[model samples]
Target chain A: MRLTTARRSTLFAGLAIASVAVLTACGTASGGGDSGEEATELGDYEGSVSILAWPGYVEDGSNDPSVDWVSAFEEETGCMVESKTYGTSDEAFSLMKTGDYDVVAASGDASLRLVAAGEVAPVNTDLLKNYDGIFDFLKMQSWNSVDGVSYGIPHGYGANLLMYNTDVFPDGLTSWSAVFDDAAANSGKVTAYDSPIYIADAAVYLMATQPELGIENPYALDETQLAAAVELLKAQRQHIGEYWSDYLKEIQAFETGDSVVGTTWQVIQNSITTGNTEVVLPDEGTTGWSDTWMISSQAKSPNCAYAWLDYIASPEANAQATAYFGEAPSSQAACEFRDDCEAYHAGDADYASQIWYWSTPIADCLDGRTDVECTDYAAWTTAWQEIKG
Target chain B: MSSAATPHVTAGVPQPRDTPARRISVFLSQHARVRLGLLLTAPLFWLGLVYVVALAALLITAFWTVDSFTGQVRTEFTLDNIITVVTGSLYQTVTLRTVGVALLVTVIDIAIALPVAFFMAKVAGPRLQRILVIAVLMPLWASYLVKAYAWRSVLAEGGVVDWMTAPFGGSSPGYGLPAVVITLSYLWLPYVILPIYAGLERVPDSLLEASSDLGAKTWRTMGSVVMPMLWPSIIAASIFSFSLSLGDYITVNIVGGANQLLGNLVYTNVGAANNLPLASAIALIPVAIMIVYLTAARRSGALENL
Candidate 1:
């Protein structure tokens, strides 16, 4: 009996270990498969498309009855829309790898990773009619394209602008210095965006202030440049009242005067009812994000996914979507559908040029340097923890 | 079978029904080891699968690496992530800060809970005790996010704390480590109080009266008698507060100013950075800490109270 019990226990242990091995192997094996090939021509609509998108991007009237553009697309294309919202790009990345989603709205940070992992296929712009109307400046960027092959359709873009309370800065601050070199002026009332990506914001500041550091791209930071940025952030950390990842946290902080100066999005500034705050581009430019709509490599509904890409990029749908999300629309024609387009500087290439869109930092330097290995996202994460310490 | 021939059966009494339940009881009573095994099987399987296996998987993942560009987990065995977590100054500092904050929160909770629990368990009348218990439990029913956000407003500059303290030339601590500690203490207070309250209830009132009747002062009675008996309870309560505080990221995110704890490091690596191996490695810190804490608690006989 004792020998049999021992044998049974050994079997159970072996089964548990085997199950773990299977689970781990599944994770590793799912990556880098041939995504088959990009569709050269559209077939019949598969009658449905499963969309994975940022919140408010693919509204189907489920959240707010009136704030939906998806219904119209569904009606016109005869494609049933089943959508899931992800809170962050990382979540969207993992969700896309499940091969459950037909189309994904990927930010620059997630787009390249998806492309590299073969989770998404390249887009043939010829197959999309609305692709032509997208802003020229928004097209074929490093984030959305690799080796000149476009991977997705441009959706919307927004910058992380510097916002300050008028009560704190009566004369108004003109530079990112207010949050960096002069952050001590505000002392414990200053705030900043809370993310590893915010490390690029500090790098952006360093590029303008200390040009001797030879920092070119905010996203492309070699070991030494990243160290410089980390040091600068460590200094700024002393004055930060709090770092906010949630928009509501920042808005409440501003309203209560706990945070008098911080990086904010245009949407957050608009949501502040007190009118005591204002957002500026600042002299040093800013970090921003641009989203793209890409079809999953294993899309079950390729035609419908293509249809979604075309439909969402159309003028009226794009206007409603971008306006609701508080970002500049992807096209000049989209601006024609809304009166407040000028407020977001829609279709303005010059303003867009001043924004450095968020991109996943990799060992391969994004700034086209061949000599030094740039720091990756993991490194930034480590540095961010240290900075916050 | 004839009733007259059945041994140990009463001649006049009706035979007990030989139903399924009777058979089951008869079988279970006779095979004691089998019955015990049957009773434990489901829970043992649940515990093994959900806790042990999941933990083992996490530990295995910690030794693996990720392809930085693709965010894909590479299952090849490598100690790089664990090594980084151990040797990295960032992890060390965050771990220290986390432990410090957790300890402070536990101490504060204990300090607050002792008096309140003493009142509830000893001083208060039965009706009042019931009311106080209900009141202590009321906050737990509300969503945790709601409470954290409410505290955010309460601790905001020129908000409730400031408005109240302004008369004394003081101000809100604002969003920072202090706010984090304060909010966490508030959040875990009920957990601390209940354990201590239950412990206090278990101590006989007659014992307290006898101590006093023996010519001991009230403070002397509490210090010499009540406190020593309360040690296990205090340790049990401390376990709750300490582990809860150690694993908290959301409360800190809401009010911790620019601070990041061990939780935040784990969260950032998992959610934002998409580095699961590193996150798992960072997560081991709190698990290891809690293991040590639980071991110490066990040594002090706190597990009995639990």
Candidate 2:
């Protein structure tokens, strides 16, 4: 059947419209652009906020009688916090997809994935009164922001410190060489973190000691850099007594004198029962995690989510939460409420700037060097298996 | 038979109407095939829909890949995951180490269980047998994690074993492969012993008497008569210990020092890394091994005896 020019044009218009609709549908699945939902407007609380957090982030004195910030938040805002603690960031990332949680205490490795998947939204700093009090060093970073839009309120931060027994290292150790190069002095007594993310620690050590390696970002390593890191780990493996993923295991090992020195978190040193151990930010800059309180994009209690975020970020609450977790509180005023702020350098932007925050490596270079492809998290996982082998 | 030929039950009762339930029962009773179909419907549905189908779906997923960056499952089929699992040296080493531990644990349990099971079945009086069986089963009442943690403390430096052996100038082996094997053997010993005890109880005293009447010694009778009869139960017990130890990631993590097993690899890929395809591939290793083991067991007529 023959058609007129006008009819043919009408058919082409329909075809073009369908193609654009299909392309946009594809775009929304993964590369969600600008998640069109508006941030919640301030209003009366929604009565509840279901939270997914790391342990001690949303305490109500159940874990320890003194650690109780949720009760105060509940009393003041009337937004009761029903929280579930996850062991790893991966578990938190998976849980966030259910959209059941109102807010998540997400680490840097998981925050970006939540953003990329549109499982979380760009948090409105204006809604959170305490957002301004957050240290400037923790704001608008790579993992917690996308295209300069903040995704969450900074909660707290901590470095992976070089912790050593006081008696074993009476001379006082400085630098990661205590765990890598000089670790042989206490062979069969050294420990390290167990996760594949520990690969970044090796890279951080290399950045200080091996200038010839030309490694810029601890997370953004190419094949050769990853191999070098793996080689160093293999050498370190000889001296390793154990590799600990949980703070409890590390504490037990230290108390029993099975582990004399290793990579550790500040919280682990506090948990040690018998040993007089001290943690330090060694001469080599370290890799660490900065957690943010992110609201779910599909939050059922948006108002309460905002209220809880603001309340948790307040000076007193942030201090209690961070001190309990043994980290530097994000709020500048939290230092006054907590005594160990000097040890953590709570408001010291210089020390915070020195840390290479834990970000999941992607093929696109996180350091913005695009000439060669960077090794991603999958590669790190593979290299880690080999290192352990 | 026709309704006209149906027999009446009682004279005083009113003529019973052919209710649907009555009709179904009547029909099922007449046709053997229908009766079997009706009887098997619930169990067959459960095993087919829940058990077999789920396993088949998981097996199908072994060939798929994941977008490692986004952590989304990609339905598109690929063999790269399977190839990597087969070729990777880490997978090879961990598989070997896991099998070695499982074998050692099985052998140790059998060696220990054989005599204990004999005592429980043949030597112990009825009262002592009951107490011995209760002793073996009591550990299982406690949580698996609690027992594993107990072993952790027992093996820790300056702990129970170290203190007990101080007089002999020996100490605990600390935590590693040896500790893993010892702990697994201790945990699965009861599983091994129960089956052997049951098998031993089935052995008639009259048969042993006949063997002895033919001038056969006790050792010869045990080897020739008791062992052959007990073979199937021993195989069943081994399958229990082997599979349980093969998939144990938690116990190893608790006591294993700087060492990993096949279970740890599968677990990390599935949970921590969010790479399900790789995890599925790694999971298939033990599944294939188990299939082969079951087949071998079947060839030895274990299926009938078990």
Candidate 3:
């Protein structure tokens, strides 16, 4: 027993030294809030610029020969574009800390975090000639601006619509109730987004249906309101066929008739050729994402990055990129360049204001109510797990 | 008897060696301790630096927490993450579900593997045995994701399984826990079969013939003689299928409908939640379970066999 105790002590000392080494080696960079480097001056473009974006964004005609935007940009500016696609905003936020990429198309869920962590800098609107053509509504918002300073230029936006099979809802339904209150009618055939951000969708419905609950902003839920939303989600869990984070899975499920009605992205609806599906923005209003092209604070080739951003936001490029990505263009002038821009409700400021865009939930109430302590993203994550169970 | 050779043997002068290797071999034969140490140094360094350090770092991070908004790790030590993981009902439920699925997969794979292995070992002609072995290994050549997608189509509502059972008034189980089990069993069956086949080969035919000569039947001989020797291989096979199924997140996602296992929980905490501390805590569950399984396996004399 005494010998074993001596050996155990030796092992513990070794483990202590090793752990200290690990902690010091992999220490995380501190959280963001600093004013980053000054805005870049437009001049001769650098040789290369790397970009991080969502899957369909920044396509260089590699995946499909017809999709060729980056190649043209490279030829036009002489700045070659190397792009990487991330699945979720959380992943994009984490990768931005590396400071390897020149610019990233970050969604609202990650944009604020990037700003707060000092990973991205405020944009100088004067550098771009086309800034005036962009919609005013997406220019200065809570996600893209801090204290009236614009940190990024808007890219594109899309809503999470209610897509239902005509075979299931023959009478043509029109509310979030088809997936929430009246979900049992299609039990085990409903699908929703598989992310903690999706909790806001439930809160949005409650804002309309259960007005007594006083849920003004879906992103800002105090304990009691969050509990109500969680309970509602738990009830809906029984009817969920699956929760999909990827558009391919959602498309496949819809095509196979495994999912009859639930939340869907515009891209998934477009990809479904067989199913007679219709998507409607419920009267309760839906959740959406407006991505911003924010340059990295430690961008090595700042000139190239700025040039790429301006080129992407230009009329013809914005039209092609947004239409290909299945979203509304950020600039109004891009509408004339594309035939179907009006159909996507591009730059429809009134319609855009009605949608609740995704934002990182925090302890402080984002709805401007200072009284109650709101639940944050971490809590939503844990609660989401519990709801799934 | 040349005078030069005689002088070298008598140590009047040293004889030249052709290469450093020859001199080193002669020196090593004289020093067994040095030879043993040199043989073990590389493997020990590799194991200590990679496996032990990574495991230790993971456990240490389990005690830390991340700031929710920043998604940055704070080095302050606390048991909160571990406590939450242990006390939470969701963790308990998912743990039970994962273990149940793992056990079911192991049973299914073993049931399918044993008879096939037996036939290959004792009954099949040489050519047939070679063909059977190739067939078992052929599925592994295809990508894991491709096979998972194939299963997804097979288990869909109007899929092959549904079409096959249509005349019997039955339907596919349709993407859920059952589908997960069936796919996992199919993926890991080759792993189960090869080890058991090797173990059965180790069983001498003379022993089986002797048992029969002593009036014992096939099942009795298999029960008394063959099973005792095959126990180690069976445990080895269980570890592969069990651990693979236990930590599988991708298969569950492709065809598991709305259900999640421990792997999904860890993945969610890591990627979507961005809570590395919680993810590390959740990851410890499968590690602990696997350690217990391996220890139990070692007690059954399987370690040497593996």
Candidate 4:
């Protein structure tokens, strides 16, 4: 049954041709869906408003015994609310694209892509009465706006910090390099945010050491910049005991001392501190991501969506949610309760100066790359998969 | 013997050709009730129609492409989506690893299961067989996710394994590969055991006694008499274990750590990255492999039966 060389070559040629035909057929089929941008029809209001939100964004209806945000919103605006919690921003984007969701709380990274895809609509800021109270910085942020059309209202934000088990490193953590570069001390005991977007951290680390890599802004990565960052992560992955995405798991990893040092969100740090860990703002400054409440283009009830956005961004709601969720407040008026908010706020004059907020990379942005010239979300995703692999 | 011979003779005889009315009477007499029953049942008719057509439609949708930026299913033809399944190095690695792990799990199941199944069918009392069946089914009754997470703590640095091995200086117990293999085998063992038990149950006691009467050794008698009878069950169980493990993502993801499988890739791509097209494409690789394996296994079983 052994095939001759010529026969094997002929068989391979046939297979190659058949594979090409299948790919060509797929290409044609994919193009067919691109032709029509059928106008989104509204007024499916009576059924429900399917919202994809962060896990803690919705109160646990059974345990918390609070008037659920959805129930309260439904009572106020009369649009029934149906919500599903998402573990990551990437997951929310996938679900929202199905046209089954009416609203989503997209983060700074995902909001633009959603707008570009027309999955989410540009919020009429005027319709949102409480939009005025939202911090000016969050309102016109580059990721949330495209061509002066704002797509989302400010929601929640938290800084990514260097967290360590207080028991393991009582000396107090100071730098990102201690975890990324100096691994002998913390070998197999470090974890990081298991995200491709964490290339920003690598860029942060490289900005200090490999100055020639020319990485200034972590998010604004060029192909060359990305290649160097990818190499850094490939090295870091070797040191990581686990690349954790879940906050609860991160806490568990920290509490068990399995992960000694990690790049963590403030909320996760807060959770871990309840155990034996302490978080430190790195000497090199820290990076943060802001979450935004965006309305879907296919929203069943715009009035209700606007109401919910306004209610959430109001002084009382913003202050309460920020205190509860362990993120910075989204409202200016909420800062009047500065003493109460200080524990959660990363923006106290000393802390504010230390944290660099996330800004979308656009053409001529200070992150050292032009918008169109920089790597977009798709490239980041593909690179992330490759990096993890 | 005369009556049985007469019946065979009647069956062998051909009926004479007849007129249209007579033919109608003959066909009606043979199949009228069964045809009427099929026609009268709307649910069965619909089930048959949907099973054939709807499930095919679902499988076809996996070929559909989703826009990376927008996350829209581009109903257009594009093999660009399937690039990973066809050519990606990581996917190839995962695919091979999944197959290897699945084969290992199947073999482990067959080794442990055959004896247990034999004991239940041939050796155990009726009550004992029932009790053993209950014990085997107990693991399947627990929540699958709960079972997987339970293995995590056991594999953790200072968890159960480390504690036990500490006296022997097995410091910093590594549970990555070992944990995944053990957990997956545990999860799908029932898939093998149940089928093998059923197959062994089908073997007549007469066959085993005949083999023994012919002065065959215990091992030889079991092999010559039992294995051939159980070939179909072994094939069926292999198909179950192989297919289940091939497509599994959760247990492996929780246990495999950096050693990613096709399931983990599909999960991260589909859930974490929102890259459905790529996920769907990667999903098809295991599916294609499964189809090939199952078909080959089925054919071999049929040949063995003949």
Candidate 5:
């Protein structure tokens, strides 16, 4: 019962990787294909176009009946759209890998993996009328591009910030150390992102604490550097009350006083923090990811896919998606459209100077890694289990 | 072998010396021509092909290695995955906890179910028994997620438990572990009650009368006579509860909160980590443990009468 937490975490990390392999096989075997061929022949995009998306990226008929974004796209293009919401980047990639949909709105965590695997094709930027309106920074994002070849259209973007209960940390909370290193004092009060991708948070912290490990960027950690970060995480897990992936669950955890501080995205922070809770951008920079809409390589209706992307990328459409999801829109024109867009806009020229945009931890790019090639996701996933344990 | 031993019957009459064609006709006559026979054969073949073969394939894939960059399974053999699982303390903890919880649920369910099933079978009239059975079965008809959500509301602040305890000067926050247990018990009560009730129904009135006539007290008659006869149904019900709790994800996910379970861990590995090998390895451990416990329980004379 009193075993060193480091040893226990290593053991769990190994188990976590083993579990992932089995689940992937089962998911791929069933429903294996892009939109079927016959669906393409339906005249002038009159038929249903299935798009794979992450939850909350697209509104359904359930959340607010009048807020269905797909209905407007349907009316504009004469194409009825059906979206199957995925809970994780892994699932979305797994689905797209099978070539089953006309489009997949992938997140930064997954879009690179998809492009490297050739599951999604390079979008013809010229064909997309709204492409010109997309911010230059977003068009050249690391995850959605390969050697300057753009693979996806920017859809939604948000930074991962620290959220804390003001009642618990009234002195204007600002550091991750107060959450991770001092977790023992905050036991049964802290929560972290529940996904494997959260291993990046540990990496981000280690670059400062264990500089000898040479972890330049959180995502670009190697095996040895990752092990050091994992050690830090094992110590932190004891303080955690919950590891939440669902936005609704995170909001509930904060509302119920089960969680005091942890990693959070803008959407959950916006929803959870009322008068009692507060969102903080720590002095040490945080991590963020941008979500994108990409045309599938196996698209049955390429023309319709282009049309769908064009309509959704418009200033009016991006404006609506940004307002609904509470994430920053990638289109510059979207911010000019409304006051709500101004609130989400993050630039040197704007007010959100504290927010750090997502950058892949490769050899080049702003805030990129200079150490051993970033920890391949394979190891991070394994380490994540141990961290949770 | 049974067919070879029997002489052919022609129109309810036995044929002492049968021709080859006549024997073939007789063999196919009654058992082979009916819709029921086709239905029975069809299901067996389907189960053998799909369930049995699919499970074997799943086990095979559990041993395969994964390609890191593409996230595809590589065509290579390795024991690293299995060893990783066996050595992992987190997996071991989750596995052990799942089994312990399942056993506790089984014991508690059986204790509660015995009396209810007894009353329905021995004390209640037919009409009353029917109504009671329906009342027990009603929850099963509802969607599982809906039921879990209902339980969450009842356990949360301003929930029914809080409302009931308000006058006692305690806040309406949940007693978390207690709420989870009560919810699981309520959800699986029908699974426990149904089998025991069915088993008790088979206990003949004559057997009870024979015991009573032997100068036995009501309690003694129940203990020595009626109880032994109901062992099979009780064992069957216990098995149902044990398995339901073993692989359950939704109940634990919705109710367990910060407390981790095997099902929740497995769900996370599969859904969040996207590590299929790990998920499969974790999934297999619970199933194997379940089989071992069930086998051991079966050997302890738990199902002798049934």
Candidate 6:
């Protein structure tokens, strides 16, 4: 009975996906028809603007008395700010669909989905004085734009760095092989980011070591490429101490010697009280996020949204927000205000180019390959479960 | 009707006034079944809407699929998610691991609680019993996250466990499956202990005395009399620990050391992947297990105590 049920379910799943492909094509075409027009010019500021953002992006001194960028913007623009924070990109996407928020800070993974769903409007860069001051490398990427049409202004960016114990590697490591090829050296002490997206990290490693795989983009993987990446991860899993989704868990693991090596963000590294750990961007590069500040298509206060976007992109506000969040500021001018800009490799185009910013994987290959279908996020999710098992 | 007709009182005591509350009370007394239904309506409605309806929706969603790019739920029917969840070796392995951890937690709690509860119910003075119950309940007042983190530190290398064990040339278990089991067992211990304590309170002292008078030794009396009577409560307590452990993901993440459970699979699909259909399908494993478990427990008369 169980065997029959399993076989029937698999058959049904295949049929469902086949039917969904046709439905999705029609849905996207219709969704595109209603793409809200971008505001051509800014008018009088609306009295209030509702903002949805990641935590620490729009602080108004409520969390800390010192972090008060939103207050200054509200005073200067005459647009009262009411900010709500979302925990994940998926959450931001869902919240934007309500058409309640005037502006949102969306990471690359979410920005494209917002544009595809017609939840955000195209930006008129001419209206913003600070648009030119932002890094040239950060703008008009596939995630933040479609067919060269800019969806939003770049906010900030960061990479997932390889962190290791100073005691474990006295000479310091330069490659991700410490966590991939030589991971067994730290057997039961190795760790990795606990998400399907982390598969890209493995792909990044594979690209360097096994160049014959013809893997162009970490996010774009055909079935064979994805399977190869999965095999590498499954091998790494044998040496893994634990997979960590929470930063505090990772920090604790590192502090108590539970995890000697793993993938981590710069912010997590800075938060570690113990001085035994150091982070490095491996030679193979790493996956990272470049967030964009977008205005809602159904925004009630488009003018206020415009003003908030421009204000946030300005050097001082950008510095304050990015500095608090532990990421590279969007503009070189913003780096002048912060002392730790060097640590984040701010304004380094070469360093930025080495980073493959996170873009949601879809059926249409991100690398622009049309000959074969690339594995989507759903496929990765299934594969991640299998890898851990 | 007679009371309404005769308004004036013949006795010295004034006749009771026919207030709105009194009128409703009189009507309710005349119709016991109506009163019973009225009393049950709110609770029954809540159960149907929140529990039954939500469960049905989850099951329905399990048969659906989501658009990979847009993250929207497509209502098109498919057997794919259910098939993947059932046939996938990942799900099977996680299910077995989760069940093993849950069973171990339940058994550990039963072992610890039986002695602690027996002392609280039979040996301790009434004041001490109250204090012991309060002590057992105090940890529950603290947040679950705080306790889990506390355990993480205690079980860390060179931590409390290590410090205490070092004198005897032993070390802490460190973070792994053992850590997960230890933390879960501690968290669910109170839930187990209280039910058994309540069961022990119901066991009359006279029964024990009578068994002793009938030439039954202490061990014989406990095995022949107390064990059979306490069986239902023990089963009820096991259900709490077992099910809670089975559905847990957070504790495992914090301390399991490279492990994932059924809850983690469901959580990742829903939160990270945004595949609600897949998550719902994965969630069905624990629900199905619980149903099978509850059926077995019901045969032991544990459901009545619960």
Best-fitting candidate, measured by lDDT? 1
Count of backbone clashes, every candidate in sequence: 0, 0, 3, 13, 25, 2
Q: Provide candidate 4's TM-score on chain A.
A: 0.82
Residue A207 error for model 2, in Å?
0.8
Tell me the lDDT of model 1 at A180. 92
Highest DockQ against the true fold, candidate: 3
Better of 1 and 6 by TM-score: 1
lDDT of 1 at A122: 87
lDDT of candidate 3 over A244-331, digit per residue (tens): 9988998988888899999998878888998689898888899999989988888888888888889999988888899998999988
Model 3 per-residue lDDT at B77 = 85
List the lowest-lDDT window of 10 residues for candidate 2 chain A. A27-36
Whole-model Cα lDDT of every candidate shown, in order: 0.90, 0.86, 0.89, 0.73, 0.72, 0.89
Candidate 3: stretches off by over 4 Å: A1-26, A29-35, A40-44, B1-42, B304-306
lDDT of 5 at A212: 86
Q: Candidate 6, residues A18-60: lDDT per residue as tens digits?
A: 5445444443122322568977877898899999999999999
Docking class of 1: medium
**lDDT string, candidate 3, B1-306, tens digits:** 577567556796565666999889999999998999999999988887687777777888898888777777887789999999899999999999999999999999999999999999999999999999999999999999999999999988799999999999999998889999999999999999999999998999999999999999989999999999898899889889999999999999999999999999999898888888899999999999999999888886778766
- True contacts recovered per prediction: 0.76, 0.47, 0.62, 0.43, 0.34, 0.56
- TM-score of the first chain of model 3: 0.94
TM-score of 5: 0.82
- Write down the TM-score for model 2: 0.91
Better of 2 and 3 by lDDT: 3
TM-score of each: 0.93, 0.91, 0.94, 0.83, 0.82, 0.90
What is the i-RMS of every prediction?
2.1, 7.2, 1.9, 5.3, 6.5, 6.0
Residues A1-389 of candidate 5: C-alpha lDDT, one tens digit per residue: 36588998987676555544554555444322232222222236635667888765566557888766777787778777777888778788778776779888888788877776667777767767789877776677667777777786888677788888888888868788977788888886777887667777777777666678876567676668778888888888777766777678778777767677888877776676466777766767677777788888788766677777777788877777766778788776777765766455543233333433443333232245453455677667767766665
lDDT tens string, model 5, B109-219?
999999999999999999999999999999999998889878876776566777788899875444244555667788899999999999889999888999899999999
Can you give the DockQ of every candidate in the order shown?
0.57, 0.22, 0.60, 0.27, 0.22, 0.34
- List ranges where model 2 is wrong by over 4 Å: A1-40, B1-9, B14-38
